[model samples]
Target: MKKLLIPFKISLLTVLFCVCLTNAGQRRLGTSAANGLVIQQIILKGKVLSAVNNEPLAGATVRTEIASIKTDQKGNFTVITKKNKGTFTVTYLGYQTKEIQHDISTSQYYTIKLDPQQNTLDETVVIAYGQTTKRFNTGSVGRVTAAEISRQSVANPIAALQGRISGVEITQQSGRTGANFNVLIRGRSSIANGNEPLYLIDGVPWLSAGISKASSVGSQSPFNSINPSDIESVEVLKDADATAIFGSRGANGVILISTKKGKQGKTEVGLNAYTGISQVGHTMPLMNTQEYIEMRAQAFVNDKISPTSVNAPDLTLYDQQRYTNWKKNLIGNTAHLSDLQLNLSGGSDKTQFRISGAYRMEENVYPGDEADKRASAQLNLDHRSENEKFRISFTSSFSDYKNNILPTDLTEGIYTAPNLLPYEDNGSLSWSENGSAVYNNPLAATLRSYRTKTQNLVSNLNANYSITKHIAIRLNAGYTTIATDEANVYPLSSFIPNNSRISGESTFANSDFNSWIVEPQLTYNRSFGDHKLEMLLGSSWQEEKSSGRVIFAVRLQTKLDTLG
Candidate 1:
C-alpha cells in the first residue's frame, strides 16, 4: 500500500510541473489564459487620400470583391478582414484603383492614395451636409463649386444652386430688395409646414429667420444674413439618410455651406470681382395710345357718361400722347450689378484664422427700383494645444442690407392694379380736377411704399478635448441677432381719398436668439489578428431661445426714407 501511494503522488507532481511550463510558454507568446488575440480576424485602420493633393478624401470605397466596407466621415477607414490570404481594393470615382495584399499579422492597414483616372466618369461627389461614396449612395446629391457661382455673378447663394441641381427648384418672391430667394430641395412635401431645407454653415446650424408664414409683409422677418462670397462649397443634402441627423428640422433635407477656413500654411489673399447687366425678360401687354382712347370711350359708354361730361375736353390728345405711354415711361432699361470680395486665410498648428469681406450692388429686373448695397464681414480663429488633445475655435460674422424702393413698387403696382390707367393730357400725368375713384392713380402708392434696412450679427465658439486615444468631449455655444427697420408710405390713392393723405407707415422689429450644444462621447477599440471591434457611446443636448419686438409709426410727411 505504501508503494502504490508513492507512485500516485509522483504522478500528481509531474502534472503540476507540466502545467506551469505550458503557462510560461504561453506568456512568451503574449497571450492571457483566455487567448483573446488568437482569433482568425484583425482590424485595419488607415486613411484614403488624394493622390494629387495628399488631402484626405472622404467617401473612397474599400473592399474585397467578396467583402466590403466604407471610410468614415473623416476619410479614415477601419475594417475587419479574414486572416486568410487575399487582396483588398481601394477605388474611388475619378481615381485609379489601388490593390494591395492583405496579411493580418505582418501587414499594416493601407494608407491608400488613388491617382486620377480621368478617363472614366467614376467620381466621388462630396456633399456639403453629409458625405456618400458614389458606389453606395442611393439618393441624389447636387454638387456646386464656388467657382460656378462666381462665374454667373450670382448675388444670392440660392440663385447659384439653381440650374446646377436636377431636382431643386427656386422661386423669387417679389424681386424686393433684401429678397433672398427660397429653395425646394426635391419638391414641396407639405402644404402648410415650411419645407425649406435646414441650412448648416460650417458645421453649426444657421437657423432660419424664424418668421413663420403667418407673418405678413409689414411684419416679414429678414432673410438669413450670411454672405455667399465666403463660401467654399455648397452641398444640398437630398435623401433621408443625409438629413436624419437633424430629425424634425431635416424633413426637407438640408443645405450645407462650408465656409473658407485657414489651412496649415502661410497667409494667402484672394480677390474676386464681377459685373453684369439684367434686362426685363417680359413686359405686360398694355394699351397703346389708340387702345387707351378706345378703352376710355368704352368706359364712358359703360358708365353712361357723355363725352362732354369728361373734365378734359381734348380726350383725343390725352389718348394720342399721354396715358398710353405711362407703362413704358414708368419702367426703365436693363439693370446692372457689381460684386467685389476679398479673403485672407492662414495659420500654424497652434493657431489659424480666416477673414473675409464682400460688397454687392444690383438693379433687379423690375424697373424704377434698385438694390443699393449688401455687405458682409466674417472672421474665424482656431487654437490647439501642443499635444492636440484640446482645441478651441471662435467664429463671428456681420451683415448689412439696404433695399431701395423703386423696383419693388413697380412690381406691386402692376400686379395689384393691372386695370388702373393713367389719364394723359398734353404729355403729362393728368389728375382729375375732382378726384374720381375710377381714375385713381397708382404712382402715388408706388412712391410712398416702404424701404427696408437690416443689420445682423452672429458669433459662436467651439471647443473639443481628447481624454485618451479613444475618448473625447466637445462643447459649443452661439448667438445670433437681427435688427430691421422699414418705412412705408401710402398716399391718398392707396387709402380712402380722405384717409391720411400724407399716408405713410414705418415699422421696426428686432429678433435675438441664443443656443448651446454640448456632447460627451466615449470610444473603445480593440484588435484581433484580422478583426477590429469598436464601440462608441455618446449623448448630445441643445437648447435655443428667441425673442422679438416690433413697433409701428404712422403719418410720415415725406416720401423719403427718413421718418417724420
Candidate 2:
C-alpha cells in the first residue's frame, strides 16, 4: 500500500504541474492550443428575413434540435451542432415560424424567412360546448393557440392566458410564497360569491373554479398551481351567446383548455427543460438600527415621555441587533427553478397515443425555506376509422406538489417597536435571556416553517361519431380529483413567552375535490366556395365536491415543543 501511495502521489503532482504550465502557456498565448489538437471551434452563419416584406428580420431566432441562436444586425446567427444533419427551425414573434431540413456540413449558411399570419375570412372558434365558425357565430369568443402558450413563463395555466389578449385581468395578492392569484375575465359580472371564469378541458366542463386561493386572513384560490406546460391551447367564451350553455357559472367568462394529443406519425420523443434563477427585484425601504433607535428616541422626547422608560433588556438589545438590516434578512435575494419534461407520441392511421411526464423544482430566495417540487404524468389515446368520420379519444393526468416555507411578515416584526430594545450599555443594548419579550427570530422562523403536499388525478374521455360527410355528433365525459394534505407547525417562540409560549399549533389540513362532466353535441358543416357554415349545440352536467380538516396541538411546554 505504501509503495502504491508513493507512486500515486508523485503521478498526481506531475499532472498538476503539467496542468499549471499548460494553463500558463494558454494565458500567455491568449489564443493558442497547447498541443496540435484544435479544442474550441465555432461556425456561425445564417440569414433570417421576413417572408412578407422580403427584408432582413433582425433578432429572429434560429434553433436546431438541441441548440439556439438569435439573429444579429444582419439577421444571421450561428449555432454549433454535431454532424450538421438536422432540421433548423426559425421563428419571429408575431410571425409564422418556418422549419427546414438540410445537411449542415454542405450548407453552413441559410436564408430563412418567417411569414406573417394571414387571417382567413372564416375562422373557427370554440364556444361554450362546441366549435363554430367565427364569421357566422353571433356569440363572443376568444382563442389562444399552442404557439401563444409557449411564449411566457407562466406559473399556472390561467397566467398563460392573462394579458395576452384583451379583457382579461390577473392580480397577485402579495409576493409571499404560495400567494393568492386572482383572475377575472371580462370584468366582474357578479355581486356575491366569486366572479372567476368557468374552465373546460377538451369539451368537458372542469371544476377548477371551486378551487380556493391561499390566504393568510381568509380563503383564497390555488389556481396558479396548475402547470402551464400541460396545456396545448385555450379558448375563452365571453358573451352571453357563448356562455349560455353554462348558465350556472356563465356570469363569468369560460376558459377551455386542451391538452396535447397524439397525431398520426411514427413514435417520437420530445423533451423540454429550462433552469433559471429569480430574486426579489424591489423592496420597500425601512429604518435601520441607528435610524430606528434615533427616531424612537426623538419620538419619546417629543411625546414628553422619559426615553429611559423604554429600557426593556431583551426588547432593546434584540431591536438594536435585528434593526441593523431587517430587510436583508426578510427578503430572499435569489431563488432557483428547474423544470424537465418528456413526451412520447406516435400513431398510425387508425390509432394514436401520447404519454408525457414532467418534474419541477423551485427554491425560494428566502433562507431556511424548503424548495417546492411538483411531478406530473399525462397520457392521451385516440382512435379513428379509415373513413375518418368516426373517432374516439381519452386523456388522463396525475400530479403532486410539495412546498415548505415561512411567512415574511414575521421576519419584519423582530425590529418592530413591539420588540424594540430600549436599554443600552454604552452604545449597544444589553442582550436578554429566557425572560426576553416574545419575538420570532426571522431566520429561525423561516427555517422552522411548515410543509404541504398535494396530489391530483384526472381522466377525460370523448368520442366523435360523424353522422354524415360534413355533419357529426360528439360525446365527451371527464373526471378530475385532487387530494391535498397541508400541515403547519407554529413554534412557541413565535408567540409571547409564557403559557402562550407553551401553546403550540400543529395542524394537518386535507381536502378532496372531484368533478365529472359529460357533453353531447351535434354539428353541421358546409362550404360554398369561400363561404362556410358550421353549427354546434351541446349540453353537459358538472359536479364538484370538496372537504378539509385541520388538527393542531394547542398545548406547548416550550418554544421547541412544535419542533416535533
Candidate 3:
C-alpha cells in the first residue's frame, strides 16, 4: 500500500509540473503574437491644390486608415496613422478625388494636385423638383448657364436663348422695343390654346401671360418685367420624362429659371454698365420727284384716265420738284440702349445674403417720346442651424417698368406717298379737302401719347427640418402681385374731318393680379446594402385672384381727365 501511494504522489507531481511548463510556453507564444500584431505609427503632412490653376483648395478632406483631417485655409493638412505604408485619399468638391500609396517612413510631406472634372457627365443640372447629376439623369434636359446668357447683348431674357438650345425655336414677332417673342420647345403642341411653356423662378410659378387688360399697340411679353441680369441659369425640359413631374402644367414643357444666390465666401460687390447703339439693318429707297412724276403719268395712261380728271393730282401742285422719304423720316436711323447693375453678395457657414439693383433704358427707333425704362431689385437670404438640422431661405424681387408706345400703326407710315408732306408751311399738320380718299397725318401718331406702367413683386420662403438623418420635412410658400396702368390720349389735332371717332379720345385701364402658393412635403431616403430607396410625399395648395377695370371717354368733360 505504501509503495502504491508513493507512485500516485509522484505521478500527480509530474502532471502538475507538466501543466506549469505548458502554461509558460503558451504565455510566451501569446506575447510574441501580440508583439507581431502591433504596427508602427507615423505622422504625415500634405497640401492640396487645383491641378488646372494650382490654387490652394481649402477644406479638402484627407483620410487614411486610422486618421482623418481637413486642409486649412492655406491648404495644409497633417495626420497620424498606424501604418508606415498605406493608401490615403483626398476629396474636394468640383474636383476629382485622388489616392496615394506612400511609405510615411521614407516621405512625410506630400503635395497633391487634384484635377478638375470638366466633363459634362459630372455636371449638375437643375430639374423639375430638385437637382441631379448629368450622369444619373435619364431625362432630356437643356441647360443654359449665366455665362451663355450674358454672352450676347439681349434685351429680353428669352431672346438670349435663341440659337443656343436644341429643340428650342425663338422668333421675334417684331423689331419694336419690348416686343413679344415666340418660344417653342418641341414645336407647337396646341393649336387652340397657347403653346407657351410654363415659367418658374426659383421653384415658384411666374405669370408668363400678360395680366394687363389694357389695349396694346403691339404685342408685349410679361417676361420683360424680369431683369435678365438677375438670372443665374435657365433650364428647359423637353422630353416627357423631364416634364412629367409638373403634371398638366408640364404638358407644354417647362422653363426653370434660377436666380443668383449668395455663396459661402467673402463679401463681394460687383458693378456692370454697358451702352450700345441699334440701327436698322436695311432701308428701302423711295422714288425721287422725277421718278414719281413719270410713274403717275404712266399710271394715268394705263388706267385710261384723263389728266384733267379730279381724281388726278393738280398738275401745278404735283409738278413741284419736292420729295420726301417717309421711311427714314418715321423710323429714324439709330436707337440707344443702356443698362446698369449693382450687386452685393456674401455669406458665412450659418448665414448668407445677396442684394441687387438694376436700371435699364431703351429708346425707340421711331424717335419722339417712344422709350422703355425699367428698374428692378432683388434680395435673397439663407440661414442654417448649428447642426444643420433646421434651415430657412427667403427670396424676393421687385420690378417697375414703363413703356411709351407709338400711338399709330407704323406700317401705315411706311406706305405713305412720297409726294405728300406731313407738315405745312404754317407749322400745322397738312390736309387736303379734295373728294379723293384722305389719310391722317403720319406725324400726329408720333406726337400722340400712349403709355403703360407695370409693377410686380415676387417673394418666396422655404423652410426645412431634418427629423432624422434619413428623413426630412419641408415647407414652401410663395406670393406674387402684379399691377398695370395704361393710358392713351389723342389730341384734337390728331383727328381728321372724315374720321370723327378720333376727336380727343382718352382711354385708361387698371389691373391687378395676385397669386399665392403653399406646399408641405416629407422626404425619406435610406440605403439597404447596395441599393438606395427614396420617396417624396407632398401636397400643394394655390390661389390666384385678378381684378381689372377699363374706361374710354370721347372728348374731355372737364379740364382734368380722371379714370374711374
Candidate 4:
C-alpha cells in the first residue's frame, strides 16, 4: 500500500508541473501578438480631388472600420487605423463613393480622385412651394440647368426651353423679334381659358399681359421682359403630383424659374454682350412683269374674256417693263440684334447680395421703324442669423420695354403685282388708278406709326424662423405691377382718296395689372431609426386687380389731333 501511494503522489506532481509550463508558454505568445498589433497600427494621409476638373474637394469623408475623418478645405485628410491592411471608403456629395484596400504600413500619403456619379437619382430638384431630391419626387418634372441655357442665345427665355423638354410644344407665332409664342404643355386642355402654362419667377407668379394668340396688329409676350442670362434654372412640372401644389393655377401646367443668386464666396462681376444679324430664311418667288402679263392673259382666257375688251381698263399698267421684288423692298433682307448684361454678386457668412442691369435691342425684319428695345434691373438680397435659425430674403426687378411695330400684313406685299410701282415719277405714292383695284402702297403701310410700351415691377420678400430642429415657419409676400400703353396713327397720305371722310385715324390703349400675395407655412420634419417623416401646413391669400381704357378718334380736321 505504501508503494502505490508514493507513485500516485509523484504522478500528480508531474501533471501539475506540465500544466504550469503550458500556461507560461501561452502567456508569452499572447504578449508577442499584442506587440505585433501595435506595430501594424499606422496613420494614413491622402488628398481628394474631382476626377472631371481635378478640383480639390473639401468636406470629403474618409472612414475605416475603427476610425473616421474628414478632409480639410484644402482637400487633405488623415486617418489612424490598427491594421496594416484594411478597406477605407471615401465619400462626397454628387460623387460616387470609393473603397480602397491599402497597406497603410507601406505608404504614408495617397492622392485619391473621385468620379462624379452619372445617375441623377441623388440630384436635388426644385418643386412647387419647396425643394426635394429626385429620388423623393413622385411626379414627372423636367429641369433645365443654367449651363444648358447659357449654351443658346435666344431672344426670349422660353425659346431656350424649346426641344429640350418633353411634353412641351413651343411655337413662335411670327418671325418678328420679341413676338409672343404659344407654349403648350401636354397639349391644349382648355377651350375657353388660355392654354398657357403658369409662369412663376422666383416663387412669384408672373402676370402675363396680352393674349397668347397673335393678332392682326402684333403679338406681345411678357416672357420677353425677363433676361435669359439672369436665369439660373428652370423647372417644368407636368404631372399631378408636381403641379397639384399650385392648385387651380396648375390646371394646365407650371413653370418655375429661378434667377441667379449670390454665392457664399468672393465677389464676382460678370459682363456678357452679344451682337448678331438675322436674315429672312427663305424668299417667296413672285411673278415678275413678264410672268404677270402671261398669268393675266391666261386668266382672261380661262374666264372666256377677250384681252382687247375695254372691260379690263388700264391694261397698260401691266404693260410696264420694270420689275420689283416686293419682299426685298418691304421686308428687309436682314435684322440686327444686340444684348448687353452686367452683374455683380458676392456674400459673407451672414449676408449675400446680387444686382444686375441689362439692355437689349432687336431690329425687326421690316425696313421702316420696326424694332424692340428693353431695359431691366434686378436686385436680390439674403440674410441669415448667426445661429442659422432665422433667415430673410428680398428680390426686386424692374423692366421697361418699347416696341415699334409694323401695322400691315407682311404677306400682302409679297403677292402684289411686280409691275405696280410704289412711287410715281413725281416722288408721290402711286394710288390705285380710276379703273383699277384699290391697292395701298406697301411702303406707306410700313411707314405708319404704331408703338407699344410696357413697364413691369416684381418684388418678393420672404422670412423663415426655426423653432427647433424639427419645426419651422416661413412667410412669403409678393407684389407685381404691370402697365402697358399702345398707340397707332395713320396719316392723311395713307388714305386712298384725297377727299376721304376720314382724313386720319388714331387709337390709344392703356392697361394696368396689379397683384399681391401672402403665404404662411409651418413645416415639421423628423427622423427615427432609418425612417423620415415630413409634414407641411400652409395657406395663401392673394388679390389681383386690372383696369384699362382705350380711346379712338377719326380726325376730320388735322387741328383736331391737337385737342387730345
Candidate 5:
C-alpha cells in the first residue's frame, strides 16, 4: 500500500508543475514571440504644412503602418501607431511627398512639411524644334503627361483628351474597338480639304488622319495603331508658330507625341494586364405588337388609304401572334475587352534601349463571330559620345490589327411591325407571307460579312553633332507606311428570292500609303546679360504616295459600313 501511494504522489506533482508553466507563459507579454519585435499601441497628433511658406495644407493625408488619417481644416491630424519608433508619409494634391521617422519615446506631437511641385511656369513643355519652359514659350501650347493619359484607360489615345485640354474638341464617331475620333483644334480652318492637325509620333509623320475604311468602322482616323501605354507625353501646338518648321501642313495645329525611352538604371521588366465586360447602359422602350398594329392602322386611315396585303403586308399578311424585339435581338449582347502590355528597359549613361510588346482584343455587341484583335511592338535606342557633344537616337514601331465587324444599322427593324419575324420555322429567311414579299427583315443586312486587316510601320532617326559649344547641326529623318486588305461578302438570303435579281456578290480591296520626310537644321545660341538670343536655319523635304486596288464580283449580286 505505501509503494502505490508514493508513485501516485510523484505523478500528481509533475502534472501540477506543467500547469504552473502554462499559466506563466500566458501572462508574459511585451514582445511578439514569432518575430521578437516590441509592439506598443500609441496615438499621436501631427500638423502638415508647406515647407516654403509654412502655410497649413488643409487636405494632406498621413499614412502609417497601422492607420491612415487626413488633416483637418487647420492642418492637424491624429494617428494611431503600433511602434514607439515609427515612420510615416504625408501627401497633398500638388505637393511632393514628405516622409518622417521619429523616435517618439519622449515626444507627444510631430510636425511634417512638404514642398510644392515645380511651378507650372518652370515646367518643361515640348515645342516644334526643342523643349522650352511654359512661361517662356511664345506660342499657345497644351501638354498632357503620361500619368494623366494612363488614368483615362481608353484604347484610343485621342479619347484621353476629350475633356482634358481646352480649345481642342474631340468627338468619338463610333463605339467599335478601333473607332474614329474627330479632333478639331481651334475650330474649322479649311473648307474643301481636310481640317486635320499634323500628327507626329517621335518625329515621324503618321498616316493616321483621313485614313481608309479598314482603320475604323465608318470614319477615317487610324489612331488605334499607336498604343497609349507606349506614350511618354503629348504636346499640342496650336496657332501658326509650328508652321515655320512644317510649312503649310502645320497651319492648323501640331500634335507631337514622344514615346517612352530607357532610363539610366538597372534592368527592369514590367507587365500591364486588364480585362472587363461592357453592355448597353440603357435602352429605349418600343411599342409592343398590339400597339404597333393600332399605330399602323391609324397611319393608313390618316393618309386616306385602305389597308390590304399589298399596301400593308405587316398588318394583314404576317402572323398576328408573332413578336420580335429587333433592338434586343440585334444589339443586346455583352462585349469583352482585354489587353496585355509587356516592356523591358535598361541601360547606362552612354547608351540606353527599350523594347515593348502589346496584344489587345475587343469583342462586339452584335451576336456573331465579330471581334477586333491587335498586336504591336516598339523599340527605341539612344547613344552619346564620351564628350556628350554628339548624340543619336532611333525609334521604330509596328502594328497589325484585324476587324471582323461591319457598321450595319438596324434602325428600320426597330420601327417595323413588331409582329414580323425575320426567319421561318426551318431556320430559313421569311421573305414572303400570305403571297406578299416582306421587307421587314433586319437580318438581311447583318448576314453580309465584312472583314479587314491593316498593318502600319513607322521609323525615325535623329542625330546631332556640336562643332562648338555655341553652335550645332542636326539631322532628322523618318518614314511611315501602311497596308490594308478588306473583303465584303453578300449572300442570297439577304434578298427576296422572287423579287430580287441579284443572287450573290463580293468585293475585295487593297490599299497602301507610304510617306517619308527629312529635315537638316543648324542652330546657334548665346546669352547677353539677362537676355538670350537664338537662331535656327533649317530645311524640310517631304513626300507622300498612296495607291489602291479593288475587285467586285457578282453571281446575280453576292454580299455588305456606315450605320443606318
Candidate 6:
C-alpha cells in the first residue's frame, strides 16, 4: 500500500507541473493574439438639429453601441467606436427618436436632423408615478395643454377639460362662481363610495377642492385658487394603473396639474385682460297675469269653491290691476366678469424663473351687490447643477378669494306668483297684505347671504440626483395649507315676523387644513439591445393636521362680521 500511494502522489505532482506550463504558454499566446487583433477606432463628430427650423438641439442624447454622449450648446457631439459601420440613436424631448446608421470608416462628420413629433399619440403625457407617451402608455390617460386652456374663457381649469376627454364627465354643480364641480371618469365606480378622483398638483396630493360644505347652497371650489392661465398641462390617469400607484385614493382616477415654468429665451413681460357679461338665457314659457287669473278662476269654479281673501288672495286681497314679471325681476340682472393678469419670465437653460399676478371678479345676477373676487400670485423657480445630474425645482401658488353670494340657488323665485310685486311702496320686501302675513319675499334670500374668505398656499420642491448612468435617486417634498372662513347669515329682515317675536341669526365657520409629504425613490433604467428594462423602489411619508370651529350668533352686525 505504501508503494502504491507514493507512485500516485508523484503522478499527481507531474500532472500539476504540466498544467502550469500549458497555462503559461496559453497566456503568452493570448497576449500576442490580442495585440495583433486590436481594431483601429475612429472618432465621429456630429451635430443634431431640428428638421423644421434647423436649430441646434442642445442637450440632445446621442448614443451608440460603443459610446454615448450629449450634445453641447452648439449641438455638437463626439463618438469613438471601432466598428466601421454602426447605428446611432438620437433622442430629444418633443422630437421623434431616430436611429441612423452610417459608415464610420468613410465619414468622420455627420449631421442628423430630428423631426418634431406631430401625432398626438406620440406626445408625452404625465401619469401617475411616472410619465410616458400616449402611444406607449399602458393605462388610459387624457391630456390638455396650456395652449388649449388659454384659449378658453373659463374661471376654473376643470371647466376647460369638459368635452375634451373621452369617457370623462365634467359638470358644474352650480351656476354660481366658485361653485364645486363633479368629475367622473368612465362613469361611477361604486354604489356607496366617494367618486372624486385624486388630484395632484406638481406631484403633491390635493386633499380636496374645497374646505368644507358649510354652505346650504353648494360647496365652494378651492380649485379657484389655482389660476387657469398659470397651468402648463393637465393629465388624467384612469383605470387600475392609477390605483396601483395611489392605492385607494386613486380608485376613481388621478389628475395631475403642472404649472408653467420659464424657458430659455429673452426676458419678456405679458399682460392679459378680459371683461365680459353673462345673463340667464331662455326663460320658461309661463302664463301671463290674465292667463293665470283666468286659470285660477276656472279651477275655483270647477271645485265649487268661492274665492276668498284667505283662499284666493290673488283674486280678492292683492291689487288686481298690478301685474309683475316675476322671472325678470328676480333673475334678470347681467353678471359682469373681469380678469387682469401680469407676468414676467426670463432665464437661461440652467436656471429659470416665472412670476405672475392676477385679479379676477365675477358678479352674480342677484339684486344685491354680490360677487366673487379672487387675487392670486404664482412663482416658479428651476435650477440645474453644472453637471446636469443634480436638478431642483420649486413651485408655489397663493391666492386670496372671497365669495359674497346667496347660500342657496334662487331658482324658486322664478315660479313665484306672476301678479304680485316684489317690493312694497316703502321700498321694502313685500310680505304682508293689510298688516297680515300673506306671502313670502323671494328677494329676502338675497339679503341672507353666504360669505366666505379663503387663503390657500400650495408649494412643492423636487430634487433628483444621478447615482450612475443608469441609476438615479429622486426626492419629492411638498407642503400645503388651506384656511377658510365662511359665514351663513339670516337677518330678521330676511324672514317674516311670525308669532309676534321672531329672531334672525348667523353661523360662522372657520377651518384650517395643513399637510406635508416627503417621498424618496431609487430608479434604474437600462437598454439591452432591442429590449429595455426599468426598476423603481420608493417610499412615501405624509402627515396632516386639521382643525375647525363653528359658532352661531343672533343679531350680529353684517358689516362687523370679521373672522380675522
For candidate 4, the clash count comes to: 0
Candidate 5 residues lying further than 4 Å off, grouped into runs, are 1-97, 102-116, 208-210, 213-217, 498-502, 557-564
lDDT assessment of candidate 3:
0.80
Tens-digit per-residue lDDT, 1-564, candidate 1:
999999999999999999999877765554336544543344567889998998887888888644578777778987666545677888888788899787766766678888987541244455532344555566666767777766666556777777888788977655544454667878899988877788766555666543422124422324435677777778777886565556777778877776666677899998988888866567767655556567777888898877752453435323244333444534445678888889898999799999999898877544456455788999999999999999998888899877654423354444322233454546433354333333545455444555556677777777778888766666655666556555444444444344324554545555555555554555565678887565656665666777667676666455563442
Q: Best lDDT goes to which candidate?
A: 6
Model 4 agreement with the true structure over 401-503: per-residue lDDT tens digits: 8887664557567777787767777978877654566666777775468788889898889999999999999998999888888887777776776543547
Candidate number of the best TM-score: 5
The lDDT for every candidate, in the order shown, is 0.65, 0.68, 0.80, 0.81, 0.81, 0.85
Q: In candidate 4, residue 154 scores what lDDT?
A: 83
User: What is the per-residue lDDT of model 5 for residues 11-115, given as tens digits with 9 covering 90 to 100?
Assistant: 999999997776555435322233654455567788999999999989799888978999999899988777788788899998998888867777858888899
Candidate 2 lDDT, tens digit per residue, 1-564? 998899999999999999889876664543335367544323537788887788888888887655788888888787755334667788888789898776745876778778887554365676665566766678667777777777776555666666776887877655555555666778887778888777767765555443322324212235434567778778777788545666766668888887888988999999999999887676666666666667777776788866432353432344455533445545555788888889999989899999999888887766654677788888999999888888889999888877665534444543544344323456322234344634433444553456667777778888898888888999888887777766667665444345444555666677778778777788888999998777777776768777777565576365476566
Those runs of model 4 whose alpha carbons end farther than 4 Å from true positions after fitting are 1-108, 111-119, 209-216, 307-316, 433-437, 556-564
* Cα lDDT tens digits for candidate 6, 467-503: 8999999999999999999889888888875654356
The residue ranges of model 6 lying beyond 4 angstroms of the native Cα positions read: 1-114, 302-304, 434-437, 555-564
Clashing pairs in 4: none
- Relative to the unseen true structure, what is the C-alpha lDDT of residue 126 in candidate 1, on a scale of 0 to 100? 54
Query: Candidate 3: where are CA atoms >4 Å away?
Result: 1-110, 241-243, 299-320, 407-412, 433-437, 499-502, 527-532, 555-564
Residue range with the least summed lDDT across 10 consecutive positions in model 6: 27-36
Could you give the C-alpha RMSD of every candidate to the true structure, in order shown? 18.8, 18.9, 16.1, 12.1, 12.8, 19.5
Residue-level error in angstroms, candidate 4, position 115: 6.7
TM-score of each: 0.64, 0.69, 0.76, 0.77, 0.78, 0.77
Candidate 2 residue pairs that clash:
212-220, 212-221, 213-220, 213-221, 315-420, 315-421, 316-421, 316-422, 502-556
- Name the lDDT of candidate 6: 0.85
Query: Clashes per prediction?
Result: 10, 9, 0, 0, 7, 1
